[model samples]
Target: MNRLLCLLIGLLCISCTSVAQKEKYKKEKVYTVSKTNAEWKEILTSEQYYILRQAGTERPYSSPLNKIYKSGTFHCAACDSPLYESKYKFDSGTGWPSFDRAVEDAVDKDVDYKLGYARSELLCATCGGHLGHVFNDGPRETTGMRHCINGDALVFKHKESKNE
Candidate 1:
């Protein structure tokens, strides 16, 4: 009986401490770091700069993926984060680029209700840069998901190409 009382008291104290710690460590959104002009010029192309930094979208049907049928990796232009793979690339006929999945750990999801519909917005995990939105209404047999990405957010890395 003595041991049982001591264990119960110890557990209660631990629980109280945990609750206090949780209350003290409140969560807050940390915005992504802004890049300087020189840093942006060094890392990104002119098109990449307009989209990733200025939140500009590329012209529809202008993406190379509109006709891309090759094998390669797609990476974020701003942060050099590997995003999508060639295997998951599919033609969604959406003008903008599309993917079935992002490279593992490449994307971070958050709530976005931009069009008045609840959506899962994905960002480049490395830089907290916005990538695109994910929807559950995609084709079956897969994840039933579509990662509708902005063409401006990514730069293609073709397997045969020597460009880094």
Candidate 2:
């Protein structure tokens, strides 16, 4: 009766408030390397454009960068900003390249709700390109953060030999 209707209304208000708070955390950021969509498409391949500019995810295990264990820095494909180091990369077996941590100040994070739930979305700090998501379920020994990133968003630059 009246009590039931009041309870339902209260619950609805609570849910709406929570959703608003979550949305507030994902404020849009101005990046150092902003470019028009056409400019981005010109420099990026179709896959890169999709993942970086449009916030699309590449199919897991599709990137050749997954198996690479060489010493190198993973750079953002859009702006060539250094992100994760190879030394921190690990086989999370989730298909995409996983890193325990990112280079300091190299990336930014925001909450994403594309999957009907909140996920910590990682982005290149320089270009604001979507890299992937970060999770707390990572190696407990180190930072305990898994920066699960899309390979199409990164370019690997192998460390140069000192002899060269």
Best by lDDT: 2
Q: Across residues 29-107, which tens digit of lDDT does each residue of candidate 1 receive? A: 4546456768876787787777765555678788776566578888887877789988887788778778888899888
Model 2 per-residue lDDT at 88: 98
Model 1 C-alpha RMSD to native = 9.7
Could you tell me how far off, in angstroms, the CA of residue 125 lies in candidate 1 after the best superposition? 0.4
Task: List TM-score per model, in order.
Answer: 0.68, 0.88
lDDT of 2 by residue, 1-164 (tens): 99999999999999999978977895678899999999999999999999998899999999999999888899999999999999999999999999999999999988788999989999999999999999998899998989999999999999987865
| Native-to-model Cα distance after best TM-score fit, residue 78 in candidate 2, in Å | 0.3
lDDT of each: 0.78, 0.95
The C-alpha stretches of model 2 lying farther than 4 A from their native spots are: 10-27
Quote the lDDT for 64 in model 1: 72
Candidate 1 residue spans exceeding 4 A from truth: 1-38, 41-47, 161-164
